[model samples]
Target: MKIAFTAPMKPLDDPVPSGDRTMGRLIVQALELGGHEVRVASRFRTWVKEGGDAAILTRETEGLSEADRITREWEAEGYRPDVFLTYHLYHKAPDWIGPALADRFNLPYAIIEASRAPKRQTGPWALGFRAADDALARADVVGALHHADAECLGAVLQRDRLKILLPFLDTLPFETAADLVIKHHKAPKLLAAGMMREGDKTRSYEVLADALSRCMDLDWSLTVIGDGPNRAYVESLFPPERTSFLGALPPEQMPQHYAAHDLFVWPAIREAFGFVFLEAQASGLGVVAGSTFGVPDIVQDGKTGLLAPEGDAEAFAAHLRALIPDPARIEQLGEEAARHIRFRHTLEMGCARLNAFLETALDNRWQRSTAPRRPHQSSGQPL
Candidate 1:
């Protein structure tokens, strides 16, 4: 099967290292691993940083033009995609190309990680909201990475159309590193990795700094890996002596860092299924993360890692205090964490799941198209 894929939020090849970009790349990799030919249909991003009616209209117009160009190019090359798939669709980054291309090519349309925000329909992002909703309604299948998203998506889509595609990663490197690295740290080394930006990331950092501060008497050292515009603010939040900043490190170098740490601590405020949690657990590091959206789906509380209530520094601190004293418990959790990722969240598992999802989407499209249509009671139009 040939798949025409696009990530409207962030292009897969975007230089910025983020969880969104990582997930986009992994999805393409998963498709290719299933023996399907996947082509990135476009890199024309439709994301509006600060919402405005004009911005949304401009993106919509540009997106339509790009869609037309792609259709013509594909026709000339005799390449017709069997499926048009998109990842990460929301009001802020609604997909404009996928729906147009799918309709033009008469292909099965599917979306992964799509969020529906009804409240945005009357705001500055009204156009984007409507566009995203239309795309969702037209999709043959919608993959929900988080259960919370599934609830809202279910309102606009059939229950069967919404499939649970949990967050996953290529855990081989982290797992291998976990097996090879020997822990020799003097104090329990806690690691946190996230871009030091404002909003949720910075809030998480602030929560983390406060939580760690409470455990001052405990034997632990903190290392943070990431850099952003608000680095100074994030740095000031943590103690200079206890916390060491590694700045931003490439993805290739993360496995070793994960392996070096005993615990992965992050106040994942409103995090949508953190990839770092998966990587940390895969590297045999017990996680202490805030129990936010989709965090529980990956990090099994009291099993692979411990979760504190979202934004509660006291609860997060308590978890840290408990784990710091007991290296045995941390090691046990780490072992289970590694196994949890291997059994359920590896690339191979994701590939198989994605292949099934695509097949289901194609089947659903065929069924819907062939089903008999009912006449509308008011106007006698096909329903």
Candidate 2:
């Protein structure tokens, strides 16, 4: 299958330390592993950072034109794709290209993790949100990673058309260090890795710091691996002497950090299934995180990791403290966590699910071609 892939959030090669960019790259890698011909359709991003009527209108106009131009350029070269695949779609970074290009070229369209909301249709992001809705409305199959996203989008689109794909990555890199990582098992070490940015990330850091401070009886050392605009602020959240900031390390060098730790701790406040959580699990490290968003889908409470209620510092501290007294339980959870990821959330598993979804999409698209074209119908509308 010749798949034209694009991500409106960020280009796969973009030099930005974002989870969205990482997810985009993973999707491409998964597609290629599934034996599909992948094409970088367009690198033109449709990310709307700020919200305002005038800003959105201008963005919508320009973004739409840019998408069309890319399609026109392809037409000139007599090249057409079998399907248009977009990664990561939300109100902030709406997909303004895939749907328009697919419509132009008369091909199947699929969106991976495209979240939708009714209220967004009439706000400052009115145009971008609608464009995103249109794409979801037009999608032959919508791949959803989070259960919450699926539930919200199912209200607007066919629940049957929404296929669940567990977020995944190539864990082989980390798997290789399993033997060496086991040796770093000594000491009550905690690992926290993510972009130390404002909003949810900062909130998570603040809550975690507070939670750790509450664990006064527990003896632990924290190693933070990330750097962002709010690095200074995030660093200040933790105890300076005990918390060692490792700065940003490349993905290739991350397994050592994961292996060296006994527990992966993070207060996942409204996270859409953090990839780092999985990476840590893959390295056979137990987790201590907040139970919210898509986190439950990954971290099995009381099994692979002990989860505290989202934003509950005392509970989080208590949970960590509870685990610290019993090192055997933590070790068991880490072992189980690694096995869990290997069996369910590896690259091969992710590719198989995606290939199945795409096959279904292609089959449906072929079936639709036999009938007369109908006007685009969207089950979701602006409230």
Candidate 3:
């Protein structure tokens, strides 16, 4: 199947450290691997970052044409993808462009990792929400990674149309360092990765600090693997010497860090779907996450890793303390986590499910439109 994929926040090839970008690239790779054609719709910002690549799309051509241009370009080429898939769409590029493109091209629309917060509805933002509502209403499939998102939007959209497609990690690269990774293991080390945002205070740096204070009582070291605005604040909360804020490492360099750590700890509150959990799990790290969002869907309590109540520092610290001493259990959980991801949450699995959904949606649409039905007169009687 040919797919027109767009991501408003970041393009697949954009040189930005983000979960959305990571997932976008993985999706593209997975679809290609699954024997499908995928074309990424790059935005001006992405092209600008690439220097000469900016020439492919002119500023005026891009700015002047608007959403209709996408359909026109596709039609001009005499090619229309079976589906228009968008990722991390908010009011920005998603609401306006997606519906227009879908309506113009007459194709199934699918959105991945979408969100709707009612409080955010006001002024110009209100229009975005309305557009999101329309898109959701007309969408053939709305892939939700987190349960909260599904619950929030389920009231508006058909429940059957919403499928839980958890963001997965690509673990093929991590296979090379099997021996070296195991070698770095000593006392239990916990790892947390991804850029931090302070407004939500969701990364749970405060919880990490408390965990460390209690971790000294237990035999373990905590390693935070990403950087953001919350870095300095979080780092300051912990002993500067003990906690390592390695900023953001290259994607290739990440597996080594994961390998060095024995466990993964993410205390963020209300996550959409923590892809880091999948990554950590894929790297064979015992998982620890806050019990909110789709995290429960990923981190099976006592099976893959432990779950702490959202923002509960003492409880999080306690769980880590208990798990640190038992290497056998830790190894067991890590193995299970990896196995679970390989079986259920791999990019391959996600793409296959997506493909199946598209096929079903198209078939259903055809059936609905074509099936024989009784004609009703203006008086409401069947003719």
Candidate 4:
């Protein structure tokens, strides 16, 4: 199957520390692995540490228009994809054009990782939400990353049509210095990676700090990875010497950072699906994330790792402290986490499922289109 993929708000090829970028790359790879041709339709841009290339996507209508030009160019080449795929369609870039294009080409329309909130009404964003609703209603399949997201569009989505496709990991390639898990230590190193925003995450971090303060009797260190606008402020609060800030590293080098630590902690405010937890679990580390959004679906509360009370830093710290003494549990849970993710959450599994589902959907469509037309009948008699 030829898939026409589009990510309107953020370009599919955008270089950023984002779940959307991760999912976009994963889906493309999955489709390719499933033996499907994927043509990503979005404004192309190459990100530089200095800045982005203006020639790629200018900050004006002209930039978006150029994207549309490329979409048309593909359509002109008699290459209408069998299915039109769009991910992360929100108020920014609603599927005004993508859906219409799908309809014109007689292809199945599909959406991945879309969300809406009723409280976000009373603004231009409302218009975008309504449009997203329409696009979702028309879609033949909607792959929701979170159960809450599936509930958000419950009015239109068929239960069977909505598949819970969790966030996937390609598994970063890295060389470990040593089996840190084997090393005997009095203190356990807790690792976390995410943006340092002041919302729920910052508050959670503060709570974790407070919890850790309460457990000063225990030996432990924290490593906060990734950097953002709030870096200076978060760093000011949790200095590097105590809570080392490693900023961001390339995806390939991320696993080594995780392997160097024993556990992963991320108590987000409200996450749709925390891909970082997936990455952590993939790195053979036990995860302790909050119990909100789609986290439970990712981290098995007890088997894979633990889930603290949402925003309860005390609970997080208690859980973290408990694992410090239990080297056997860490080894057991870490291996369990890796096996669970390797089997269920790999990009290969996701893509294989996606390919099978699309092929089934296409086959259903063909059968419906070519089925024999029955003679018109009224009540109990044929006309």
The ten-residue window of minimal lDDT in model 3 covers 374-383
Model 4 CA lDDT for position 102 = 64
Candidate 2 or 1, higher lDDT: 1
Which one is best on TM-score?
Answer: 1
Could you give me the TM-score of model 4 versus the true structure? Answer: 0.84
Model 3: number of backbone collisions? 0
- Give the per-residue lDDT of model 1 (tens digit) for 220-298: 9999999999999999988889899999999999999999889999989988889899999989988999999889999
Task: Give one digit per residue, the lDDT tens place, for model 4 in 171-199.
Answer: 63421422433545456788888877767
Model 3 misplaced stretches (Cα beyond 4 Å): 42-65, 91-93, 121-124, 184-186, 201-203, 368-383
> Candidate 3's error at 270, in angstroms?
3.0
- lDDT of all predictions: 0.89, 0.82, 0.69, 0.69
**C-alpha lDDT (0 to 100) for residue 184 of candidate 2:** 41
Give the per-residue lDDT digits (tens) of candidate 2, residues 242-325: 899999998789888788788899998988888888998999988999988788888888889988889999999988888877
For each predicted model, how many residue pairs clash, with residues at least 3 apart or on different chains?
Answer: 0, 0, 0, 0
Estimate, for each residue in 1-383, the C-alpha lDDT of model 3 and write its tens digit. 67777776576667767667788788778878778788864452311222122232342245336566666776688766666777775444334455567666666677877777776466445544555676677677787777778787777777667777777767776545434664445677778775766754435777767776877766666687777767777677777656677887888888778878888887866566677787788877788778877788888898999998988888997888778888888999989988888888877787787677666555544443433642221122211
RMSD of each: 4.9, 4.7, 7.2, 7.0
> Residue pairs in steric clash, candidate 3?
none
Between prediction 2 and prediction 4, the one with superior lDDT is: 2
TM-score of each: 0.96, 0.93, 0.85, 0.84
Residue 251 Cα positional deviation in candidate 1, in Å, after optimal superposition: 0.5
